[model samples]
Target: MDVLIVDDEPLARERLTRMVDQLDGYRVVGQAGDTASALGAISAQDPDVVLLDVRMPGEDGLSAAHQIGELDDPPAVIFCTAFDQYALDAFGTDAVGYLLKPVRAEQLLEVLEKARRPNKLQRQAKQTEASQSSHNGRSHISARTPRGVELIPLEEVRYFIADQKYVTVHHLKGEHLLDETLKELEEEFGNRFLRTHRSALVSVQHIQAMERNGDGHYQVRLADTEQRPPVSRRHAGALKDLLQKL
Candidate 1:
């Protein structure tokens, strides 16, 4: 398998390269420091798997992945980030895997295998399907501020937190208090978002880890951010099952 290591740090790239070297069936075709070099290599070498860094000097991995998707045969993307939030959006692009920093060799090889034999067409089809589902009735979601029925891009939303009668939409930019309740939003967007707590709906991508507290209560840790949302006891089991899959 042809692999491209895209990261800002030379040591990180070298570490991954060493792991790939030890593996029998894989070869490191190229190494890039930043987004420009990464994209150029993709255009030139057309690697089979791009081990992309979540944070970079110029263009971030997520932005580069969007551009790469425009290619006729884009390589499989496996994100390598020190942070966590990018995983959610990363998977939205048919990403086969997401690895945290100082990646385990076993995990890398496992993801590489999955990337090697995946139904790319089916994954793309699912994205198209999800997008189509988002479009049909999203416009009807009333906004609180005169932001007035803002067309919330389905993928951009980090999560929705219910507060009494209103649910606030949390995203990278900031927060918006939408008029709809958690129940209403969940019914409309349940397929894409997962219910993490009685009062919170987490973007599955933002979830990096779910830990059990001293009292056996569970809490969710968000990627790239420090805030941890406590999981309702009722939803703890379900959230644990979901975390296992991620």
Candidate 2:
């Protein structure tokens, strides 16, 4: 199992590194000291399990976990904290487990076993492949805005909104008005990205949860830190089924 250790303290990172080095079937691929650097490492290394600290200088571990969860294939997060009180809330981030600090070798071994399972790797590979294919197919998307020409990577887009002839790209950062029709982008990346509406083609990975609103319309919780998007009636059933399978 490839592993990454994320902790702000040098001593803590070293300790976890030694533990991972001692394990037979696991290897330490990378380590990071802050949320930004940790995210960079996660993108570059793609480790299977991330031994993460709860408290840090800038963004806390929970905040980083939320970012990681947005990725196409997030590594299994195991919170390593000195306190046990955070365990109950950790599940909201989809953490596989939590290990109290001054961690025991036996406990480390047990969680390592859990993290090394084949199913985890299989799912990760599938997501990686899907993301790669989706990215490859999206190179043709170019949008002309008042500022300049913007190149929209299909993977970065969360959804789109149509207004007559133009479609606006809705991403985590902001919106961009693209020249291509929604149907054109949808046709190119249909297998990897799903058209949740006539105007919207949402990346499957960013979808967090689905809910039936008071008016019986379905809505989707996006991986965005700010807000959730509406799942139009046309694609609501399919989105619900997709969420169930995940």
Clashes found in each candidate (C-alpha, N, C closer than 3 A): 3, 0
Tens-digit per-residue lDDT, 146-226, candidate 1: 655565665667778875456788766567887676766765666566666656787777788888778786778776555
* Model 1 lDDT-worst window of ten: 119-128
**Cα lDDT, all candidates:** 0.74, 0.74
Give the TM-score of each candidate.
0.48, 0.53
What is the model-wide C-alpha lDDT for candidate 1?
Answer: 0.74
CA-only RMSD, every prediction: 18.5, 15.4
**What's the TM for model 1?**
0.48
Model 1, C-alpha of 130: deviation from truth (Å): 24
Q: Tens digits of per-residue lDDT for model 2 on 121-205?
A: 3553464466567655644357676778877665677776666467777875578887677656655565556655544567687
